[model samples]
Target: MSAPTEPSRTSDAPGRGPDPRAERSRAAALAAARDLLIEQGWSAVTHVAVAARSGVGRTTLYRHWPDASGLVRDVIAERISTAHTPPTGVLRDDLIRELDGLRRLLHDPVSDRGLRAVIERAGVDPVFARLKEALYREGSRVFRTVLDAAKARGELAADLDPDLAVDQLAGPLMYRRLLAGRAVTAEYVERVVDDFLAAHAPT
Candidate 1:
């Protein structure tokens, strides 16, 4: 991908405090960028394209997101953040809920492609690679929370590694849906949860 040419910063007036209009413009541009990624693919989310689609000034768009990947990173982050699983105080149920949320997100048309766009580029680009790492940290937060709660309640084996458990639960669903080209059914989710409980349940 070509580097985005730096755009000149433009402002309406010198501001000393928070600017709500700027926030709104940024939100609009991000929405437009996300739509472009889903509808047209990664190449269509450039600063110029986002500005045109969002009706925001190109300078403003570039000022916030210097390139397409920056826009993509924000979009992916926001999308991932929306899938919250309020822990039901049951370890198995919490893990299942989180994985199911992931399955639905992977199945969603918008996330299906928008996430892939950045993921596809992460291997070669350091910037995008960092973005992928950050996204992983975000996606794993729920697992970490649920696992911590379970371990505290003595519901899990004392020696179980929380991080590994997180991967164990989320990995298969993602692999089956994104890589193995298989259907991620509710039954599959339950089986995954059951297996996780079997392996990690307190002795």
Candidate 2:
């Protein structure tokens, strides 16, 4: 009889945690994909191009992402799911900080281009539209959390709607930047933050 066979190795097997080197390679590929998307549009992102830019092998990228859309979904999801809200204790200050970050992002050439590409693609592609919707919902959670905290602390009305509030705060900046082709100046960002707080914050 053959010697007792060992258990098949699987990702969930003991001592089989993810490889750090593979993680680094994945990070590099993601970074390269993000840069290429921003600089040359989504059309420029391919397994070979990402591998070339990231210094990883094309096969490695293919094993992970399978296709360009898979990579795009991840890149967009990574950006849209997390919003940084500085904890200042003061709701107004926090809103200002968040909006100020948005202002700066809109002003960045790379970020601006990437954002525009996502928006434009979403308009015409159902797949991208779904991804965009997911992003929007996730992004809304940031403002929702802030609003909930403010409500709990008696800084905002208990009935304040977070979704509507976020739209009011973020919609103008995006519209002005993408549709109106106008710069979201620092002053403009401050005004929106102030206006939203004035209208919604508890007296």
- Local distance difference test scores for all models: 0.77, 0.73
Instruction: Compute the lDDT for candidate 1.
Output: 0.77
C-alpha TM-score for every candidate: 0.77, 0.71
Q: For this target, which candidate reaches the highest TM-score against the unseen true structure?
A: 1
Cα lDDT tens digits, model 1, 1-203, are: 12222222243345554456876787788789889988987778899888888999987776777666778767766665546758889877888888888888888866777668768888987767876676678778888898888888999888889788888998898888778888899889999999989988899
Best by lDDT: 1
lDDT of 2 by residue, 75-188 (tens): 655554345765677787777777777777777765576567678888877757876676566556557777788999988877888878998999999999989999888789
Residue 158 Cα positional deviation in candidate 1, in Å, after optimal superposition: 2.3
Cα deviation in Å at residue 40, candidate 2?
A: 1.1
RMSD of 1: 4.9
Off by over 4 Å in 2: 1-14, 79-81, 86-89, 108-111, 123-127, 148-161, 198-203
lDDT of 1 at 188: 92
Error of 2 at 157 (Å): 6.8
User: After superposition on all CA atoms, what RMSD does each candidate show versus the true structure?
Assistant: 4.9, 7.9
